[model samples]
Target: MEKETTRIEAFSDGVFAIAITLLVLELHVPLIEETGGGNSLLKKLVAQWPSFLAFCLSFFSIFIMWVNHHKIFKQIYRRNTPLMFANGLILFLATCVSYPTALLSSYYHTASAHVAVAIYTALFVCINLAFNLLWWIASQDRQLLRPEITDEGIKRIKRNYLYGIPVHTLAFILSFVAPTAALFLCVALWIYWAYTSGKLDLKSK
Candidate 1:
């Protein structure tokens, strides 16, 4: 007997919520001396810009991932063992985001910045690859999809997912050579994905 997609989706949603919430823990309050005034506190906050940037980027990335996950699961009618494992992989990688976000926040501008950025981008690459695999598994011969979902829609989703692998891989490579540029590319990818909104036209041929 096949399992309903609801259980998987509910579990995935919990993971998303936990990951996003963990991101906030990376933003620490700055310590000030007794003589420090309001202006000094403001300066300290400004100095923690890297933490703010990492938090925003990771939050948006996970948010967009959750939205896309919802869109994909809407077309999936049932799940098998492999499909469950695939979805689990996506969530597993997503849960890893908090660690890298914290690393990037702490070392983004320090001498270890490149290493931190590389690890950060590498996690995203893994996440992207996991998504590609999950989509491929779910859409294979429409094996797990709803009856109303069309072949053309599956193909479109696969094509879009395929695009993410190389782009993220490139960003990972750039992390070694140009960490800042790679970080920017990662942000750009998130923005582009958010703009696309992951909605498929199930009625399309």
Candidate 2:
């Protein structure tokens, strides 16, 4: 079980790495001709603000997810069929991140900006729910957790993962009318996860 879980973690890391790397593909070089109308290269690069912002947000989002995933698995000593499927769900969603990121880069300045950002925001919602489900499944079987894990620790982790669902859902709803504000909410959530997730007490044996 230990080796199997370890392999899954390694595979998941590869997926996250690929997804983060793919984000850079949307960042195009500002061509000289594209900036031919008396526009400087710096100005053209600056005009691609949406691309840059999307890349940064997606990159950090994937990076932080990988961190929390590794932490979750640390306490999972035994595994089950449902646990495997839940983890697979997360990896699948991780790969899908690049698509919405590309959408943002392509349409964020146009009338479709709301749609693009909404999709991007919605993806975050899905990813968070997947993680919440994964942890819930893992916790269902106490035997799956490390021997040292306390009941309080389990409850704490559950509460922490639950925080994402409603927050992301709110952002998703706001995406339709106030996409920029929705994106700002995503940034805030990312910051929240970065600081709070590491505080989980689920330590491995």
Candidate 3:
């Protein structure tokens, strides 16, 4: 019999879709007809700077999560119930990130922004933890993982999670004391991820 698709995979896809869509909703339609000029339209958009910032961060965060999830799933041949559930938790946490991101953009430079950033970073760390748990279970079971993948490759994957969690945790804490610095650190982290993803051994299978 063909193996049934797991709940986790389906739920993750749904959650990611929702999260990305929610981000765009933050953008308001410009009342350009009232202003009646291209310059006015541009100025209206510029005034909603918070929405633009939210859109950028939300888009990047959703895309990164999707890319990372895709890479992890590509190596798996099948999924068990527990694996599916673990992935669901990760997706749930990921979904929560959008709200905080929106809040951060709207209330940035205020105490609310600190809370929002902290929540966003916490969601990220939780998702990573869930991924770590899912990976550990799959690696321990062996059957779920691709046969040709090396222990070293798996270790490297785990290492990525290890590093990501702490960095995010630190950023979360720092947001209260220095939100701007924390944000800059996160941007730097993403740049590092861009470089590292290029270096990952795609031939690990």
Candidate 4:
């Protein structure tokens, strides 16, 4: 099980790396000729602020998810088919982020902005649900977790994972009424997770 866990983690890491790397592809260089001159190129680049913002938000969200995934696996001593599939679901949603992120950037301040932002937020909600399911499966019966992992620790982590769902759901809900605010909340959530890394840290006595 340990060997299998290692392989799964390795594969997951590869997926995360690929997903994060793909975000940069959405940021294209402005063509000087199309812009009329090099001076106007600067303005074109500046106009891409939405792209840059979306890239940063998605990049950090994936980064935080990767970190939490790594932490969860550290406590896992075994894996099963269900857990593997759940993890795969999480990765699939994460990889899908690039597309919605591109949409959000392209449709920013347009009629379609709300749809794009809602889609992006909805993807995150699914991703968070996947994480919660994966954790629940592994922590059940205490069969897959390391012996040193305390029940308190498991509960804490579960609470942390569970909290993400509604926050993201709220963001998705707000996306319809206020897209920019929804995006800001999403970014803020990721920032909160990044800064609260210690909350997920499990230590063995």
Q: Which candidate is the best by TM-score?
A: 4
Point out the worst 10-residue segment of candidate 4 by lDDT: 1-10
> In candidate 3, how many Å is residue 93 off?
1.7
User: TM-score of every model?
Assistant: 0.93, 0.94, 0.84, 0.96
* lDDT tens digits by residue: candidate 3, 1-205: 2333445556677789888888887777877575597688778777778768767876886777777776777566667888878877777777776687778777884667777777767776677688788778777776787767788887887787677778878988998888777777777666666566644445744
Worst 10 residues of 3 by lDDT: 1-10
RMSD of each: 2.1, 1.9, 3.0, 1.4
Deviation from native of the Cα of residue 67 in model 2, angstroms: 0.8
Tens digit of per-residue lDDT, candidate 4, span 1-205 = 3435899999999999999999999999887677997678889989999999889988999999999899888888888999999999999988899999899889986898999999999999999999999999999858788878898999988988887899999999999999999988888888877776677778875
Model 2 alpha-carbon drift over 4 Å, by segment: 1-4, 37-39, 203-205
Candidate 3 wrong stretches, greater than 4 Å:
1-11, 30-43, 198-201
Write down the lDDT of every candidate, Cα atoms only: 0.84, 0.88, 0.73, 0.89
* Steric overlap count per candidate: 0, 0, 0, 0
- Candidate 1: Cα lDDT at 77: 76
lDDT of 2 by residue, 1-205 (tens): 4434877788888988988888888899977788875658779988989899889999999998998998888878778899999999999999999999999988989999889988998899999999999999988888888878888899888888898999999999998999899999999988998898777745644
Candidate 1 clash pair list: none
Q: What's the TM for model 1?
A: 0.93
Candidate closer to the true structure by lDDT (higher is better), 1 or 3:
1
Range of the 10 consecutive residues with the lowest summed lDDT in candidate 1: 196-205
